[model samples]
Target: MAELKRKVLTLSSGKQIRLYGNSVAISRSLEIGEGYAPNILSGNNEQPGNTSAGVINPYKLTPDELMELADFNIQLWMDLKANIRRFGVSSPRIFTGESGKQPTETTGNKKTGLSSRQQATE
Candidate 1:
């Protein structure tokens, strides 16, 4: 079985907690498989007024500030990639009909630990 490399995460309380191997990773199958559209929370177009959540630049900074904002984003992504070594991918249960295709009646969406279906098997 694949495993996620352990890493430490610093909480806002100044406490460091190790993210265990059981920590769930992003699902590439459900995210970009045969039939999947990116969700609203997908951080794609992230400009001044092009955020996915809503249009609200609370700082009201000038365009020059965008460089600083981008720098922060780069640092965050770099850190994440460096620490995270493994990623979980979901293989959803799709009930097919005679036509060989059907809408997903039960997809294996899950948080961390054993998946909903995996738990059932256990």
Candidate 2:
């Protein structure tokens, strides 16, 4: 099941906007579907072409905040990707579990197995 969570973001001006889903899932999807570059080089004439990500809408985030949110999400994703590589998490879902039990996981092993990921924290 999709769990809905809330996040309170305080802007530079001391205004707050409540974002949902732990972190805005919108950030990443928008960054891709909206053609936002997380890193903008100096002297670049173009500032990301489109602001619309056809399917998902950024509910209450302003254009400026949306850009910030994209960078936020990009950094988080990159960190996670690097950690996944370092830890060699090939099938994370096998331990996390999705809809059904993983094929290679046995009931006894699942109960007794202690993985190193259990020790790592963000």
Candidate 3:
């Protein structure tokens, strides 16, 4: 197999994590799903809480601090997801449409532009 390109993400604590393309990302996600499936199948339906993930907040944070923490968590998750190649825009070739084009008003008089009621009548 060909070598996959990697992007290194540097954390706030000076830790670095390597990000990879779709192949590894998909595999990792699927592995997580598979691990969760067994617990769900056996009726261990407890949520995977932050404590389970080994994150413990040692301080009694204020509301503002909690909000900041939540924002940081959300942003980090988004950054990770965005960096995973398959989860993001895979290619530039998939054009949505021509930009700055305005929609034109259509009359129901023509075959292609007929309204549902007009078409049904025909």
Candidate 4:
């Protein structure tokens, strides 16, 4: 496996955003694969006031637009949290050994002290 790298983006408000491998993984999972069409949020111009008053209102998004934004926000938050948990802290070391020997292995060509499946049988 390639060594994992971290990316941190600092927002204008001074909040730090950290992205790890898990973040990219989650994004890939949510992406629309080949042969899938993306949904486009629709919007239309709305005149809320009387036309005779000479007032023109701005464009407004339909209900689907609001829902899409909400869903996107929720997923973004979830992915952020998941990535942080996956790589934010260093994991504890399970074994230690000197330079020449593998930490999980000891003396013999018998694969001494290893679990049955890990040991090579003659």
What ordering of candidates by TM-score runs from best to worst?
A: 2, 4, 3, 1
Query: 44-107, model 2: which lDDT tens digit per residue?
Result: 3344875543323425446797789668767655654554565456644223223223234333
Give TM-scores for every candidate, taking all chains together and pairing residue i with residue i: 0.23, 0.27, 0.24, 0.27
Poorly placed runs, candidate 3 (over 4 Å): 1-58, 86-122
| Comparison by lDDT, 1 against 3, better one | 1
lDDT of each: 0.42, 0.43, 0.41, 0.41
Candidate 4, residue 94: Cα displacement in angstroms equals: 24
Residue 8 CA error for candidate 3 (Å)? 30
**lDDT, residue 35, model 3:** 17
* Error of model 4, residue 7, in angstroms: 28
Sliding window of 10 residues with minimal summed lDDT for model 4? 30-39
Residue 6, model 1: lDDT of 45
How many clashing pairs does model 2 include?
0
Q: After superposition, how far is residue 89 of candidate 1 from its true place, in Å?
A: 12
Q: On TM-score, who's better, 1 or 3?
A: 3
Candidate 4 matches the true fold with a TM-score of: 0.27
Clashing pairs in 3: none
